[model samples]
Target: MNKATLASALGSPSAFGQSQFAFMRGNAFEARVKADGGAELLRLVHERLDPEAPPPKGGAVPDLGASGPEGRTARTALALREATGTGGWTLLDHPLLALDVAGSPAFLEPDAVVVHPDGSWTVVEIKSFPMLDGSADAAKVGAAARQSAVYVLALEQVAAHVDPAPRVRHTVLLVCPKDFSNLPTASAVDVRKQRSVTRRQLERLTRIEEIADSLPEGTCFAPDLPPDRLTAAVESVPATYAPECLSACELAFHCRDRARAQDAVTSLGRSLRAELGGLTTVGSVLAAARGESGDPDDPAVAALRRAAALRSEALGGVAAPRAAAEAVPCP
Candidate 1:
């Protein structure tokens, strides 16, 4: 079964996007770079990664292609081992690396990996985002960094299995379009910070086995089940919902609706929840703001009351009176 279904079962399904133009463009650019025995890519690696060292006259583009993912991954590992032993410049195009994430193996396919003459491997990340005038969007670059960090982590795991473990460089090559042209511009992005963050986050994740063990007996998440049964099965597992989940999760809408119906304060945003202190519900906050019931000594309640008074004063004869009249009385 696909890991996506497993993720959905764990209450973290991803949303699908309609347009794949950007992905296509990225693939096209990557193909362009790898064309002609990856001559252009070799040039970029020489210029950006190792300007002082001698450039690769002509490198081996070993085809590690196989039938299935596991077969291909095995082929990649063998190719990596061979490349490291030879101590030559080798490009493993679309090499797969498997990392143990939260007691599960997550296979990562990097754009490319360059094995230096010194047996050190560098992760290459190709992005469609243009680097205009030697600069790209900071946020886009950061996202790319995080992604490369994951690749680096996976590479390290593979390196561990090999004899005389190869060094995985912390600085990854980031290739992007130069200005508006199809030409590729390369930069070495240091992903040490991102690597640490990703490693820590992955380490902190709860194991899928542990989550599965916590589920109620006979609970099922089969898609063909009745609507009510499916909903009940899903609801049997707890989900921590927030606005940021909307971008990453397919079940965000369902979680959002449930949260709003229950008046969960976290649905607003994490920052708001932090600011509101003990006032966890919207109704409770509003009641405190209206001076109905709440500890006056609480800083959040006092601030709410102050803000409410200021708003009432500013709109004294206008929207405030009408809104107050129409509003439901505090229970």
Candidate 2:
């Protein structure tokens, strides 16, 4: 069963939901950006990333029609190979690329991928956020960059199989509304660091088959099962929960409840959990802070003790204020 269904069965459905208005607005913005054979989008790419190349003129918008994801992925690969040998601009809209993730194939459809005149490819990300004074929210930009990096990685996989592999640029084009207006603006964001990090993290994931083999016999996650049985089945699979999971995972609430019940330090944040070293529980952290336990030679324990001492001294030195009349001098 999917995490959402499991969560609903456990009476802990996800709290995060997108508003209809925001959804509609995003769709409209993307349409405008990709309208007219992606003329405006192509122009932006030429202006920002490939200024020395000739301006794009009615670039080829190949027909990527196919029945299913598999068909579409094959069609997209064919179109990309055909476009690579040419010497003109080509915009591939919603191309499906297959990436091998942890010994499994995962399909990804990027907003668009542009084939440059020099046979280089650039990923494009369209967002509804407003870019004020040529700048958008840093957090949103970072998120978009990370997402685009995944697409780049997928594109690279396709490139590797080609006779003459095309270069997938590390920089992606981000399109957004300009200064609270509907007018589109573009920016070039370098995602080399994000790509490297994502590639490393994905490489580190354990194969799904190995994880499944380790599970107990007959450990089913069917939502129709009784609540206790379903919960037990879920708990059988160990999970590393962090605060960021609330946004990305459907079972985050259930995991959060479990973490809090166990006084797990990860319920606070991943960074704090990493900094705490061997202290995996909030009780251990508190005990260390109070000087009741933990080795003094440990850096985490030593820092906690120093902070506790400073807090106590600050609280002890706090003096009571005088009466208002006494301070005012009868003025």
Candidate 3:
């Protein structure tokens, strides 16, 4: 079931809604960049990624409209083939590409893609963030790079079917507002490392069919189901909840409540959870730290005990349950 729908059923809808002003700003920036048949976009791509090639006079902006995602993907492929054969610059605006993810196909529509004169392809990512003094926020840039990597991976799948497969450039063009102005600026972000890591991670995911088969028989997660039934259905499937899920998963808040109730160490974050080792709950970790339980030979338990003792000594031997609780990692 869709996590967003399940989250709504549980009365804890996702808190990741985009701001209206930010959304409008982003749309405006994208429109400006793609204006005049993508004249500015082509200039940025040429200046940042293909300076040596003849300055782009104009490029074909093909009509990729179709019935559905599948039809659009097919049209994109055909357009790519034709563009490569003609050996000219072409801009594929919002082209849909498919990538197999966990035994299912995920269709992704990137902002734009440029076919170079040399038959190479470049992914373009446009953002509203300002490029101040020739640079933008590093964190935002890194996030864009990772996102572009996914598009690059999808493009590679499409390229494989082409007769003379075109090279999908690892360095993508990132277009953003120029120094507080609406004018666009571009940067070439190398995403080879991000692409490799994303591909490996996607490959490691367990198939959806395997996970569904493991669920209880007759389990249903329809949004209209009773709250109790929907909750049970969702809980029947195990999940590893981490703080990072807040930004990515619609069910993050629901999972966080359950994790906190169970004193699951993962509620704090993955790093702290890893450090706690076998002590997967706050209560157990505290007991082991107080030397009231747990094997002394266990390194994690020993470290916790030592840290607790040091904290007590620093407090001049006063019983500090509150302090201990405060020091404990939890949501």
Candidate 4:
């Protein structure tokens, strides 16, 4: 069975799963865009990303099909090398590329990889999000840019294998529906910053060997393990919980529950944690606000005390100190 099935069996929410409605909609939109041999897709890339470059003239979509991800990745690398030598427009649909992340290969599949006439490649990311009045949601666009950055990083690995390494453009093409219509519109998003950040983070990640060494001997993460044993095994490993994990991690809810149970101030949010100084727990922060136990000289504690006093005064000065402390917002 796949990882998702194992996760479901283990009572862990599927992080990679999406709603059927959204999944179907996105798939249909992408299929429509890529119909007609991706003619519209090429036009958008030419018009939006590289207008100066000649329009994709009779591009070829080489068949790079293979049974598994590894074989497909190899085929994609071979196609890229050939495309570079030809110096002609070539579009690779759903091509697989692999990047070494934390000493492991992370395979990525971009919507399309367009090999330009200049031997440079562009990563294309297609989304169903509409561009209303030439403006799309900034947050969604940012997410697409980050995703494209990952594809770019993976492409660079392939480029390294080619003689006279071809360039992987930092600017990617983001294609979306135009103004609530199914017609495609494209925008060039520069992902230099995102690419650098992702590269650095991936490079700096702790190796799996170190983590395994730290775990107790005979520990296993098999999904079929009993609930109690699984919970204990999970708890044995350390986790750095933050608000961002909610959208990205399957175990985020579990970690948040643990944090809340332990009174960790970080359970609320990272921003709140930063302002709490030495007060790392919700209970400690509340105690400091109530002036029960904290270094009065610390700016964070002093500010909390001042804010608590002002809040009490605003409430007609009738609120008891403990009650006023409890009313202080942790957000």
Candidate 5:
């Protein structure tokens, strides 16, 4: 089994060293939601997704069956930490955290952890990309920050159980080399904003818990459900909605096929933007489809309309049928 795929499927950790894909499939099906294009697409994606149905010939060379320089970067980070003999912090690579919320649960895990002698703790997330140049993009950094916040929230639980020293608050991402031969760079991060966002996410998480609690008895999660199903549910997002999820999303072949059938959105999380139906998209929809009338006299809505219009006009028609109306012109 592809460990990265399974970790993604089961909402488990993304450890290169770990080789487990047990609950991935069942978890994937169970994670289907109407908002995310439903389970049918997920099933279709999974069914058609495998590039390598046959087992790979290589022995232990491919850790977790992950690919690209990013995969090696993750594995090598583990090796380098041990090689450096750095013991100040807890090294949690692709770790999973199960956070308790009044009986229901939420999970958060970051790639690495470092406990300073001064008692403060930092969460280390490893990504394979250059931190320099335009390599460190906003959306990617947001993803890293969002993922790291889970660790800090989970660490809060540890704080309650063990003797309190310093809270795990900061996040540090270790970016992979743009050039393979070069050393990986460490990018320190403050995910306090992520923490704030997490607070809101937990509110939504709590809602999901309520939904699950009301479900029928025999209709529990699938066979491949991870230890904490809720977190697993959150993480088991399929490639269709989350094609940019990770370096080794097992269902890529399927997702690419699906995306190719549709029009491409190359700037940032274009596909994901289509999926979420949030501010950016809603704004776009209003501008293009609705045209000038999409904006209410409300100042905020009008500004958004103007911006969407400007974007459409600037793109010179390459954007899309509806994407043209994304950010409308301001009044």
Candidate 6:
């Protein structure tokens, strides 16, 4: 895998991993995908493969770095231009396949890898942080480390085929901005903590790999749609979860519309919980209100019993005058 391509692959996976299942609804996502391009006769096949969505790309992205993202590439290119003078970093972009924690594919693509004359490789994950602080954002640093770990995994599988049997070590170079709000920094990156953070990620991901290998197919924690299905929907696309929704899910709008028609008491467990207090679905709430008790200590049962007592006092054949003390609002 080349640098740019590796970036695309590793880039989106981190954010998209949790949403895999939601994205599996083929028809909707497919429509969303193909809506980008034209000639959509059967194109919107974002989820599963049914001749609706197009095939997935061989890999993710590869050109983002070259475009001077955050000035990382420009700086790296300049450094290479100076270091090699006539030549650039041997591997400007490349992908490595290290097993993910689940033994599924965890990949890495570096902006550049400094291949030494001695055949040792120093991996660089360029950053855009400014040089002034000599510090890195803890969250951003963690993400880079995790991303780099995937590359470390990928290279283990595919590096030997290259010309040099480069001694691969987990090295990351973070390129940052000279100033926070200023032009992007393509050049300077802090590497002091790269190895420490990266080591932890490797350990974590490998555990994931072990667990994945242990499970059978069709198990939880596996991709909602198989890799093949993902590939199928590359160009065709599908209906998105939903644009105006909270999670950006394709069905979010639909669910919201459905929710508006019913009160929480008549809806799901959570809704009842919200409306009637904890564990207060319609059945349980009604049961309590009727004084048909379950466990006396149960809050639901108690609340219902209390309401029943109040109603009986007020609605008995001869109603007593209102309790001059206070008023009870109608539920």
Task: Please list the residue runs of candidate 6 whose C-alpha ends up more than 4 Å from where it truly belongs after superposition.
Answer: 1-89, 94-101, 159-165, 180-331
Write candidate 5's Cα lDDT for 1-331 as tens digits. 3445544554444533332452453233233211132222222222322212222121111122235544543443343233222322222334445566545554444544443323444555555544565257777787777777767776665555444334555544434333442334345567888887876767565454565566655443453665467334433443343445445454344345444445433223555454323334443445434454444654555565566556766887466646645443343
The residue ranges of model 1 lying beyond 4 angstroms of the native Cα positions read: 1-15, 18-20, 312-331
Q: Candidate 1 on 37-115: residue-level lDDT in tens? A: 8888988998998887678878888998898878888899899889985756899899988888899887889999998
Q: Kindly indicate the candidate among 1 and 3 with the higher lDDT.
A: 3
Model 6 residue 155 CA deviation (Å) reads 2.5
Per-model lDDT? 0.83, 0.89, 0.89, 0.85, 0.46, 0.41
Model 2 alpha-carbon drift over 4 Å, by segment: 317-331
Q: After superposition, how far is residue 122 of candidate 5 from its true place, in Å?
A: 1.3
List model 3 lDDT by residue over 96-141, tens digit each.
Answer: 9999999999999999999999999999999999999999999999
- Candidates arranged by lDDT, highest first: 3, 2, 4, 1, 5, 6
Candidate 4, pairs of clashing residues? none
Cα TM-score of candidate 3: 0.95
Error of 4 at 36 (Å): 1.6
| Cα displacement (Å) at residue 103, model 1 | 0.9
Tens digits of per-residue lDDT for model 6, 94-147: 322234443444333464454333334445554543446556677767677666
Q: Residue 318 CA error for candidate 1 (Å)?
A: 4.8
Backbone collision tally, model 2: 0
Across residues 230-271, which tens digit of lDDT does each residue of candidate 4 receive? 778787789867888887777777777788888898887888
> All candidates: CA RMSD in angstroms?
4.1, 6.5, 2.1, 2.2, 17.0, 18.1
Please report the candidate that would top TM-score against the real structure: 3
